[model samples]
Target: MRKTDLLAALALSAAAVLPAAAADEVNVYSYRQPELIDPLFEAFTEKTGIKVNSVFLNKGMVERLKAEGRRSPADLVFTVDIGRLNELVEADVVQPVRSATLEANIPAAFRDPEGRWFALTARARVAYASKERVKDGEITTYEDFASDKWRGRICTRSGAHPYNLALTAAMIAHHGEQATEEWLRGVKANLARKPQGNDRAQVKAVWAGECDVAIGNTYYMAKMLADPEQREWAESVRIVFPTFENGGAHMNVSGVAMTRSAPNRENALKLMEFLVSDEAQRLYAELNAEYPVKPGVPPSELIRSWGEFTPDDLPLVEIARNRPAALKLVEKVDFDG
Candidate 1:
């Protein structure tokens, strides 16, 4: 081959081999919004010198991961709701994480039995009552909504939403399916309007005098209060952490998992451990307004001012297991109707 031709052939022969993640890099597939979680990742990178790549997804995490198969670039999966996390586990896309740091920081109830997932933060499903209309101690328990006293006075989003489904599934755990069915029917009877809008909308309903109270997640109060436009909506309602007659307040989680196809397993596990560290937990409470998963780390000032209560000890796995039945109950009751 001539010199120019030989050079061209050699350059062509040098295939561009796409390497896996660099030694100091980890990739994440997340269902949570990037803005809410970016700070945590940024902090992780700052402290550990590991580059974190995040892919945000609203749907199809399982399908995408399944499609990627063993060649998937995802090292960790971050998502909210036990239902979605369980979907990953059920789909067999995530592998068990055998980290002592994870086991030490996370409670057994919040960790999967086989160690496939770990709860990083928790949110309680609580009631939001109109400050003007509802008495301070009038509704103190989840069962209170089932009383005729709350009839035509309560508001909530669709019962089948994963948040509500997890809460309902908890009801089934504490009370039998039969009794939970009765309680749900009673709660449905009390709807101030058609099961509509989101957790924020339910609070907005309370502000508009459309309802006396609404059932929603505890963190939403901080979120609403943070927004200038929604301040009035937040101010109109008081958070009520309602306990079950037989258990603590129902809670849900946003969690993390190691992908079965992780190419950077050590760095991925480092990121996981960092996430559960005190610095990261503090950032989570302060930035995202979520309750930290690590013990001894208190929530932000806003959450503390809301008062403290025991989170129900029912394992999230137990709650997730009942999601199908919970959805069936929501449909059976025609809750959204």
Candidate 2:
């Protein structure tokens, strides 16, 4: 990895604050990996003279920016999941934006209502069930995990993982906290083994005959299919879009937000607007295997093959607001312990 791909640390000196040499540049603090975003940056620079200097952080983005105070070099932040985006908003490290282009490109359900964040890509939290062991329509909703039918057959990562937490948060948005709590306990009781590994690992366990079903993001299927080693895992299962009892499928996003202390405000906003452009949306599908936030910009061929379904239209802010409750519910159930 390049030196720019540094993890989160308050190690930057005053001089290090300037991510690029030129004045017409945007410094990005991103949780999205460098490889996933470098192509987009190259395209942006090619189209406009504004340079993009990005540092990828795996964790603690809100804390780092808060510690940097008004001196933080970040002009924009790109991160996965609404939970992290909400953290930036709550920390007051990022400010709301107003851009006609962005507003036009992104759907209301996908972007922050206040414009504090805009989604660049969307991923559905779908079930991966064994094609051989699980029959058609065996599981059809998020609530199905708690049923006696799936006991000791469901696999997932830690409930505290942001992805699972987001799903839990969505559950809170659809059902009240009290109901979500009971549901969590039920789901916990159904775990095939102690919740372990990444989403792919869950799918692997399913393929390995350890579980009949796993919960994971849609993009993981495309990613695993592209990898020679993981392709069999991808092929061994079928993607199943599950709904909330009262809502459609649960969805998550890879989002962008503007830093509160943007030195290159104009350039930063320009980069953000450009990210939602049709061209960037297409690249997002090609490079990241993610669905675009902009309508009419089709997903990559491999992504299209996975099929589509209606994502729950619940506004992301509602789900984001429930993150704390979701975390608390996870802890209450001792889901990971």
Candidate 3:
């Protein structure tokens, strides 16, 4: 064969071998419920011809990944809350991938600056008040919950709850630790009853007339509204969009990251890109009742019905960053008391 022709043939052979070198399946460790995240996985596989094998767990994924170490088959990690994602990154379990697609789709406030993770969806932590008992235009912000007027009328889950912990962290980030502690004290003084139960229970307290107001994630209301048995729990309350006195509502995210030792690196990246795309962002909203992180994607009907407001815009990383100190504050205040 002529030298030029032979070289071209070898290049074609190398190109053919490249596909074979890639991993056939991507293993995922996901904190999302299977039902909520499965459609996106199926769509990704269908489009890219890369099979996804996932272990869905509500918790303990971080410890599992640590235990497995380099022997782990996981190529990607997914979870709600910046703290969990930050925990994985801080543990050296996640690797950074600087993808322009990720940067463009997700806001800087919702992602790790180092590219360690990208938030896929956002949910506001806002208050729900009784339509009759709580006067409209009375409670305009989270800070107001500390006022004496709200004493014996406010309800909230324990501060130790991850959701409330994150919100408290945000408060500390914005108001300073001293001010945040003071706010907590005032809020505590107003609690109709001791902080207890999951966020859903707080809303139920509103329904039972035990409290006039409750703080919870936006999605919890949707969950309650959808369940026939829990309709009564949702019916008595109306969502109040708290402006937080000056800043917007406090928000947090569900995020995704590639494992540091990801065997299916390329496919893992493809899945990450697919997740932040407009189509998938909308799916995230529709399936999970959370706000899309991507700009311009309209929120699901449940969220829209609750009305729109500006988000707090405090960098979400701070929520994770302040977690330790926030927990300390929660402990010092005896938030469960």
Where is model 1 poorest over a 10-residue stretch in terms of lDDT? 10-19
lDDT (C-alpha, whole model) for all candidates: 0.89, 0.88, 0.84
RMSD of each: 7.5, 3.5, 10.2
lDDT of 2 by residue, 86-145 (tens): 888888988989989999999999998889999999999999999999998787889878
Candidate 3: segments with Cα more than 4 A from true spot:
1-22
Residue 193, model 2: lDDT of 93
Q: Give residue 229's lDDT in candidate 1 (0 to 100).
A: 96
lDDT digits (tens) for residues 133-211 of candidate 3: 9887887988788889998998898888788888888888878899999988888888889888888898888989999
How well is each residue in 29-142 modelled by candidate 1, as lDDT tens digits? 899899989999999999999989887778777877776677777899999999999999999999998989999999999999899999999999999999999998998889
Question: What's the distance in Å from true for residue 302, model 2?
Answer: 1.0
Off by over 4 Å in 1: 1-19
User: Considering lDDT, which of the candidate structures 1 and 3 is the better prediction for this target?
Assistant: 1
Ranking by TM-score: 2, 1, 3
Instruction: Name the runs in model 2 displaced over 4 angstroms.
Output: 1-17, 20-22
- Residue 77 lDDT, candidate 3, scale 0-100: 90
Output candidate 2 Cα RMSD.
3.5
